[model samples]
Target chain A: MARHVDVGDLVDRARQRQPRAVARLISLVEDASPQLRDVAAALAPHTGRAQVVGLTGSPGVGKSTTTSALVSAYRARGLRVGVLAVDPSSPFSGGALLGDRIRMQDHATDPDVFIRSMATRGHLGGMAWATPQALRVLDAAGFDVVLIETVGVGQSEVDVVALADTTLVLLAPGMGDGIQAAKAGILEIADVFVVNKADRDGAETTVRELKYMISLGRREVRGASWRQPICKTVAARAEGVEEVVAAVAEHRRWTESHGEFAERRRHRARTEVEAIALESLRARLSARHGEALDGLAGKVMAGDLDPYAAADSLIADIKAEG
Target chain B: MARHVDVGDLVDRARQRQPRAVARLISLVEDASPQLRDVAAALAPHTGRAQVVGLTGSPGVGKSTTTSALVSAYRARGLRVGVLAVDPSSPFSGGALLGDRIRMQDHATDPDVFIRSMATRGHLGGMAWATPQALRVLDAAGFDVVLIETVGVGQSEVDVVALADTTLVLLAPGMGDGIQAAKAGILEIADVFVVNKADRDGAETTVRELKYMISLGRREVRGASWRQPICKTVAARAEGVEEVVAAVAEHRRWTESHGEFAERRRHRARTEVEAIALESLRARLSARHGEALDGLAGKVMAGDLDPYAAADSLIADIKAEG
Candidate 1:
């Protein structure tokens, strides 16, 4: 629309502590517009200043509560923090439901803590295409730490963990049948594991189950305790809350010492750039050959030819058109 | 890599009854290679011939059982059916962990049925990228109906259903939390609502809750029956399986009569192509610039500038190099 926003200018404006510029930069990356992707690419160097922690769990497992507690812990340590709470968007409205964001009001009045609610707008990618870009904005915004909370415990939610330096998976007692969180990929990548709502029944059983599951799947990496620590917490009561925070800090130390933190972030950066580049390119191709593609689609629908063959012809046609 | 495998040749071989050809065709689409996107564009027109039915629910809702029963019912009707059992990939091994393919035991030896289990392999779009091409392959391979079973409930799973002609959402009894599925976007896309494991306790209550939620959320659409039918079934016993099949057919009939089926399928086809194009472009860009991008990422980690600004420089450098 306006030759797309320059990622560099967006980054510069965001550097100047401009909210609208930060929002615009996130939009550019999320939309994966060609111009915006370019800008995001330019801003990629300023990331890694902040420690990224991913918080994920089954819905209603007190992930928000845990995130709120984590924010408080960081604030108590006199550290600035940013929380990117990802919420599911209504398919009909394409807006965030914001149900979980209501639980994160403890830090609303604290200027040191910045929280943003994002909706996964069915943007081909489960997370809005711009999420990594948004994270970069948070990274550059001078926050000492940024915590990403996924909407749910699905594959896309798992991807959110991959984008973080330390992933903390929150689990609750008596949630579902005996299916452990690791079985769903939640327990696999977690640098630290947290069992929230420990005041409930089956807390011991849940802890035992998580321990067993982690033992079954734990990978031994050099110089780092890959053993996913089990921290019990009653989030609402703030009981054992500081222990979870300590576990996160311990994890950061282990990752940094083992040099895995920089390695993982580098890989994530590559993945983010690659994914955005592809999304942008595809949008471009779709706009150019949409009509010819429609014509071919009509012919295939008429039962004149099969889809594979039809695809072949269309590719040739697109090449010729180009 | 051999010019990325010719889409037409692969299609022709597949049409000529070559099994490996079909497998390779699927691999192409799954990889979302630049060449395969073209193949998918050509394949979309021939897709509407098959009845694309989507099955989704929360993890461990007996969704796999329900899908198995429905596939068995459709096969008994003398229809050639293709089952795409989508499961989450193991985070460690990057493959199907529980072996979803083995779960469809009844269809194993039936020539008229083709069963395939797919996992989301850390792709930004996950199964969304591979689904349409996979469906097109099955459609062109002469399957009368294609069933898509998603791994988890949320927006991505809902997107899978939106691409289908009929969507059946399964809920098991005793899950007081099934209402969360409705709130999370599963209820809106359901052509047929299924309360699976009807033999269990609280089945009736689950159905009542679903009905209540549906009633509250239902909106009137012109010539569209937004009344999602709640069908109960004991999947383990294969009881009430026929009614589920009947409901799917009934929904198909109504949509066809109102011309919504054809239109939705058309929209789905185009969207599928767009997804492929984007994924392909991503794959290509990632391949070409992955290492150079990684080099820039090292500096980003060292905090030379903001990550956003770093990304901008990398994108510009890549464009200039090209």
Candidate 2:
């Protein structure tokens, strides 16, 4: 099955902006193929040149429309653009968000733009593990700006913020959002705010709520030197999109000046390394622990042993076997 | 502040059917308090007596209405029941699902019924790790049956299926669900199907869809001896609830006679024990891996070291240190 992919040749083709090569590289990352190690080695040097921006918000906040607008904005500047529509499908629902692809058809015929819809397949934490790799593939392929849009303002949204240098938290007018969905964590991660569908009612109030939340967040000592700007857009018409582009560029300049840009990237790399290492360790313990855990599970099920004690025995076996 | 509280005393109170004690024990499990090992050891012996049922579906499928109906049915049978309404709130939305609580107000004052709504606290995998502990607390406290209902038909629903002795997958009329949300995995886990909101426009169509999906599922190697019966219900009025309750009872009898009861419990215990052990191993690696991984991450960011190489070095450090 294409297991014998030449990593170097693929990276070379991707660097020349071959869309299929880029797709193949990203597929390796998504599938967790064995060649990922080699792909990473080949792609690493060419990454870190692209600017990563994450767009996240509640469903119906016009994320796809906004993403299309942003792609048009960046492409006008003569820069290649890459889009990852990361759908956090209900693990059972197999809900692939196929309709989103229809919305992005505007860019389908453009050679300079790569539009992809990726599902969080198999595991709850699957996207977190695979997304950075996909970003690396895009980055190495020389996409000047990569826009990552995730559906829903859930854990996946927060994860998108971690992967991006600048995060745009979008909201639609008339939603009467209480910032309750921002959960205390997203308030810390959002770099810029975008009020999409601003032509509708309550747009000003949504901006007011975001402003109030930002002021409240400032008191808690976040990027104190950089003030985040709020931009309004009717992305369906590409109205006020340039203002968002300006805001992102401004945020980038501020972060670079404050050294927060490098710090964020380094921090992201640390998380990436730790996750990969932890997964490796987990795999090492799995085979040996399987049979013993089955027996211990039976004991616990019968009320003959507690779970905590059984867990200890399982971990203790790992040490003894090693 | 309650650090010095005696685990044995709490267990004693919980066993006497004290709602406060049951609530307190669940809080410990939710908060992951230091006394958990003691609480788990104490509760393990008294567990294994409760029938755990999981009710999950897409939002607005009348899960709470059905839950309330089931609670009434079980109470009429003179059984004390515990309801763990596990709300998998969007990690950012802080969405607590408070409205569902109001629906269950009918049984709020009854000493025989205890209802609690728990948020997926911090981690993405938080629900999977904590739900079982909460179930054990309720099981140990002598509840005849425990209903575990989650917000969405996502990963949390699948987790509920793993925890449930009988899983009721509910669907509403006119939703046109293609078993797409069931995602192949839930179809294998659902023991009983309920077409809720039967008084609505498309109830019969929903039931027919379920039957078709079940028949399609039967062609595979799943529960060959048991043909899952779909009961149409307007749970808001408790119509047709008795049939659904009878279906669950029949399921319990089948699982018990077929030995799937012990097997499922054993499988769940194995998963629980593995999660706890992995968490333990993860903690042991954290302190040491933190400093080294930070430096490696810097290199990875600088492109001098690829992430895979950095991860390998980090894991090697673990083996060397241990």
Candidate 3:
């Protein structure tokens, strides 16, 4: 029966600003149904319409509080906001602790704000296959801005969040080498850095360390003027939240004015589409030539041609046969 | 020129106990050459001749010290030992900090000891793709026991370590909630557990937590009598190293007595062979059918069909063409 639901109807209901309909569509996408993939493809045009702000850092960082504050700030200006919190819990568990959601309860009845927690679902490379799907749903549901907060500082999670329009990396004080998380891989990708819990001891030191790290990685592209911004915040008390919001607004304006936004979006589109293509090809190849692969593999194992050449020959044969 | 080197000469040198030749072959495997893969394949039958022990845990768990102590204990018993420390550092540097090497310096010049540090290069998975090649080299080098210590603990690194004959997960005191790393993914993969740095506080609590976690995950399968053993060690001081070694010996005996060794080795072989085959197919597909792939991908992204179905259809077409 769920399969019989026309993806078109779901998309239409979502576009009509029906929250339940959008939520249902998101569930379908999370399930990764073949039919829903079609719906998502159809719905993508509605996306690239929302300002995607990504938040990522170590687990204990107050990303949730910062996101909550941002949501309030966006709504206070009469803007509808969607928070797509990518929790690291297992989807098989069917739901997260929803701790991030609980923190955003101030907007529970706002109707102008939508808060949804997404599980990473153990997807390879960190971004859930369902993430793009969720983004589409939120876009169709009439959100002005989408805030995506992910769990950890690993390379894969950072890569996923880097797909966002404005990637904000959050840090906290006393993370003793917590800057290591940023310096390792995530720092280079961030558009805005936030030293959350700025009231804590060593907050100044953390900020300085992050500042030093950022400056170290910076290079002068003589003709182009682009410098990633850093902000400090005591997110729990909402101090400096306005500064972060303003920074994001400034970054957005700069990107739009410089035409960098369109270029970045196009680049992301091409990469995502290509990834889809590669996944498709791999699937096809595996299915069509399973046994031949096994046989050829045995030969390769037994003093045959190099794996690369064997692959080339197989592809040639496949193409010739086609 | 490098490919023309005779395998027999290399193998003869290795058999005659030449570490230089063994190191050269290991480097050859690390290069991931098709010819080297073929040579390693031919050498597979002569492999599984060494007791391969995998040491893994969170970073700073004193895995190196535990491994060093374990090696020292084995050598004290007159066993020929080889250490393959798989470092996930930059290969271009071609130098290890030798933190673990420092601990094991007593055996650096020992005639029966061969220690090699393998750097991760171009391997999609955590372990070096040339790991099997290195193992074969170590085997031919006549080492009775080859200890492969994988640096760091993540899903892929743990999987690589699990490939060993006996996987030992080392933990340390003050690893509060760090045991969460074990309760979930890497711990279940352990055949033997070693609590290193037991001299630190919370040692007793760490032990209790592991026991609880292990017991929770244990399956009482009918007709199967294997139980994973946990040992606490102050490896820096060589305390409890002998017990960890004894547990390892016991696990080996249990595996052999139950004929699990042959089955595990067979599974490993199948995995290695399949990887080789798929890798070969990927290269072949990319080179010969690269344009066809581009065409199909364009169509798929242009909203033609579901990628999985497109994949299915492509496979059918390939099989039909074949």
lDDT of 1 at B103: 68
Ranking according to DockQ, highest score first? 2, 1, 3
Question: Which parts of model 1 have CA positions greater than 4 angstroms off?
Answer: A1-47, A92-99, A126-128, A177-183, A220-225, A299-322, B1-48, B91-94, B97-103, B154-156, B173-179, B198-205, B220-225, B299-322
Error of 3 at B259 (Å): 5.6
Least well predicted 10-residue stretch by lDDT in candidate 1 chain A: A91-100
The CA lDDT at A159 in model 3 is: 44
Candidate 2 A-chain TM-score: 0.91
> Model 3: per-residue lDDT, tens digit, B1-322?
4448777777778888888888778877776654674556445545557888998765456767777888899999999998887655332223244345576797888888888877654223324245655776787678999898864333335446655888888777654333344322455567888888788778888888778766655663211467877798988899999999899999889888988876665545444544444444434344555565555555443445333444444444444544
What candidate 2 gets wrong by more than 4 Å, as runs, is A1-3, A57-69, A88-98, A117-121, A153-157, A168-259, A320-322, B57-73, B87-108, B119-121, B153-161, B168-260
The segments of candidate 3 whose C-alpha lies over 4 angstroms from its true place after superposition are: A17-19, A52-162, A166-267, A274-322, B1-8, B11-17, B58-155, B169-197, B201-240, B253-266, B274-322
What tens digits encode model 3's per-residue C-alpha lDDT throughout A150-213?
Answer: 7543333544575578889887775433334432245656778888888988888887877776
Per-candidate interface C-alpha RMSD? 4.9, 4.8, 6.6
- The DockQ of predicted model 2 stands at 0.32
lDDT for B116 (candidate 2):
83
| DockQ: the better of candidates 1 and 2 | 2
Q: Which tens-of-lDDT digit does each residue in A219-285 have in candidate 1?
A: 6322345566889999888888899888888888888787887778877766665544454444445
Two-chain DockQ for model 3? 0.15
Cα distance off (Å), candidate 3, residue A133 = 4.6
Best by TM-score: 1
Q: Which candidate, 2 or 3, has the higher DockQ?
A: 2
